[model samples]
Target chain A: MKELYSLSAHELQKMIAVGEVDPATLLDAIFDRIGSLDKKVRAFALADKTKANDRLKRASEKKLGRLYGIPILVKDNICVKDEATTCASKILAGFRPTYDATVIRKLEDEGAVLIGKANMDEFAFGSSCETSCYGPTRNPWDLERIPGGSSGGSVAAVAADETIAALGSDTGGSIRQPASLCGVVGLKPTYGRVSRYGLIAFASSLDQIGPITKDVRDAALILNVIAGYDEMDSTSVDVPVPDYTKSLTNDVKGLRIGVPKEYFIKGLDKDIENSVKKAIDVFKKLGAKVSEVSLPHTEYAVSTYYIIAPAEASSNLARFDGVGYGFRAKESADLIDMYLKTRSEGFGDEAKRRILLGTYCLSSGYYDAYYLKALKVRTKIKEDFDKAFKDCDCIVTPTSPTAAFKIGERMDDPLSMYLSDVYTIPANMAGIPAISVPCGFTANGLPIGLQILAKAFDEGAIFRAAYAFEQNTDFHLRKPKL
Target chain B: MESIDSKTVRHVALLSRLSLSDKELEAQSRQLTSILSYISKLNEINTDAVSPTSHPLTSLKNVFRKDDLKPSLSTDDALKNAPAREGDFFRVPQVIEGK
Candidate 1:
């Protein structure tokens, strides 16, 4: 029965279909796992055991969907009808959503069971899960250390076997970074690859919701279910949703992988660098060609990201000012007082700081100087990637500079925290698909991830490359000894 | 590089509708100043004659669904989750007459 926890969602469904295992029994085993493990890790804000059981009952009565009876967790930022979609903010602390997010609707249509809302950085602001209102999520590998955020809860849940897989939003590396920290496979699909209809805004221009799972195949399977056109989101692309799972195979012969010279520069941990290099050598052994490439505007990614992301965040967050919905102060003498008091008491410190910086950047006087300049620099950075993609099938680099650090190690210094996201942020900015898979582990045994980035809407290439890597390496199979 | 100060931080906070205490203002002022200074390194790069980009893809076509009415959440369902509400409306504080 304990081995049931090790089965992938796809494998479990197949077992259920063959009548080798019962869905309700498997669901009970999953619930038992969650009940036992979730207390220490603090992954979910709410787990709907009753609702999941009821859904399982209904599933037993009828023909099941592709992912029938597969239990999944979603980031708090994604809306689910009648569930708390707080985005892990005090302002929206007890607010239940009125409708399911597009992704949730799709998940329901496909018969995937939503177990709970995972914790996250309040309003998805911080890179470390420490900023969550509930409490920090501990990495399953080492309880004292941090799980990366704002999707830390989702990643941690999947890593700790609390759930089979999860949906996470990536705004400047949220999904991939946490996935890296927690030893899970995470994908940040192209900006418009997945519909953003129900995701709470956090740097809207950069936000994308993708899957975090234990393997590349599972990630691709979830992406296939969730990726599609949605009328609710204006930015959603109307392109056809290809069968991402079907595209995954261990075939990368003659594929060109670009190794960016800038990413290999100083500041990369020697262990992480060596691990990624070894992973690339495995690709070479699998019949793929690797070449050094240049993204000349590499250094500017962090700077440009800060400006654009904040500027857009400032504008999008304007809606949360104690007006439309969410938290409100009780003793306000007037409207302005109400607005001031509610927001001040509601938002966390990091969120407050970002709103100020973003507001300043978008202010009339500084708009051209900061926001506009960052935008222009961002164009150059995208152009660099565009040029490089012409020469390579995908770009490969260390997902994070090093393995997950202790929770408070870099939080005091925001700049250092921001630098941790350098390798992954460029994909969000350029609107390309990317994934982070376990490449190796640090000497202390924390997992390191290697990122694979593909051209816009070319998730096929990413799936193919990641599957190829997983096939040649045992890194993805090593679970933390939690 | 842009200079940051306590007064500037206060002004920005007000504009952003966030009421911070004097102590928070002081701390945030210092923090924002440092972050701004670090990010100001972009000033050294010469991005002359480059166009600003808002989205990664160049095609600016707006993908829209038809204006057909689909079932939206009921008003009761929508307001069921509201922290504060009045009859048929979300209960926010008065803004117009006082202003």
Candidate 2:
């Protein structure tokens, strides 16, 4: 029998439901794996063995739901009541949320077991996980390289078989980029498709919670549970969420696939470029029609994201002031001093950098010049997608310009780090659903991701295409030698 | 376009309520200058006729919940994460200086 840790959530679910494996036995296998390998990967911020065992014991006795007894890792940014929701930032080090995020509640309702919290870029700020206070999550493919960021730890854990699957939040490709680098399947749902009621805010407009899994089927299964309308989150759309698993069909014949010209630019590594081109060819072989499409405003996506994301981050992060909850300075003389000292001492360099940049953009004299202009250009970017989608059902591109880089390689240079998200940012900007799946590997054996994007609220289209592509290729079957 | 400098960085940090050391200000000023210069590329595009979109979904309606009372966090749970608390309230440094 295959080790329980190596199986997908769906596989585990089937095994547990058939009386082949007990929930506690599976949890024990996953925890034992974490104990052995986590010292090197640094994927989890906190893994409460006692609490997890308690949940496992209780879940095994009850009637199973869709994900019965399946272990799921959650990013620290998503609140799990009474558990540490640090967001990999010192500002929230000891803070335990009073309530669970809507996604967590829904996942638990479907019988998913919460294993632990994954590490991430502090406040989900950087493209590399190095900014995390807990420490960077190393790539399972190459231990020396980074696991990509914001959701790095989530992807890393799933890739290393530390957890069956993980939930990660994406703001400017936090979920997808890491999923790409770590060689896992990641999906960023259309904005407002999943409720954000208890997700610690990074950038309200851009932030979303999605799944990082070993395969596309598991991604669809998790989405089925988390995607829905919630009255608590005003931004959540009331549109009825279809059963996502129904869309995972093997037939993608005659599906229109758009190849965006803007994504295959100069800076993209030749290996990644060739790998993505080959993935496109696989779609062609599978009977999908492929054609080139243009998104002219693509060049401005990273720049615009930098402006808008930070502007919202500055506002959302303002709630972490000393007065309410979270970290407070010990020896401040006054309120102003307290605020300054608390934030300065608590936040990491990347968080401080973004907050400062946001403040500069939204300042009295520069609001129109920076923030407003970015928003206008954002509309142009969205219009480009709108125009392209008229000709095609989905767009295919490389998830990241290159395979995972060595840790600290670009940490000193923020612009280069920001460029790591160049290909994934447009999907977030347009509020479209995008998924990253393993397509190939580099010469050094690092994973490459092929990104598939569809029109807003058209996650079904992406799933049909991704599942077809996955079935025809063995990329998703390969596991790291960890 | 205006150039960013250490002084400008200090001013922005103050506005952001984040205190930075002199060394951090100097380093961040340089980085911010480069990043801002790069982002300034947006100004080259012709956006004169385009309207700003604050959110991608413009057709959303205001969502309202029932007016009836619902369960909420108790005082202890609400203040559970506060670094300092006094009698079920958050305690902070005094704001008004004058007696």
Highest lDDT among the candidates is held by which one? 2
| Residue A78 miss distance in model 1 (angstroms) | 0.3
TM-score of the first chain of model 2:
0.99
Q: Which ten residues in a row have the lowest lDDT in candidate 1 chain A?
A: A55-64
lDDT of 2 at A330: 88
CA displacement after TM-score superposition, residue A19 of candidate 2 (Å): 0.5
Q: Which stretches of candidate 1 lie over 4 Å from their true place?
A: B96-99
User: For model 2, which pairs clash?
Assistant: none
Candidate 2 docks at the CAPRI level of high
- Chain A TM-scores for all candidates read 0.98, 0.99
- What is candidate 2's CA lDDT for residue A221? 96
Docking class of 1: medium
Alpha-carbon DockQ of candidate 2: 0.84
lDDT, candidate 2, A392-414, per-residue tens = 99999999999999988998999
TM-score of each: 0.97, 0.99
Q: Which candidate is the best by TM-score?
A: 2
- Superposition error at A112 for model 1 (Å): 0.5
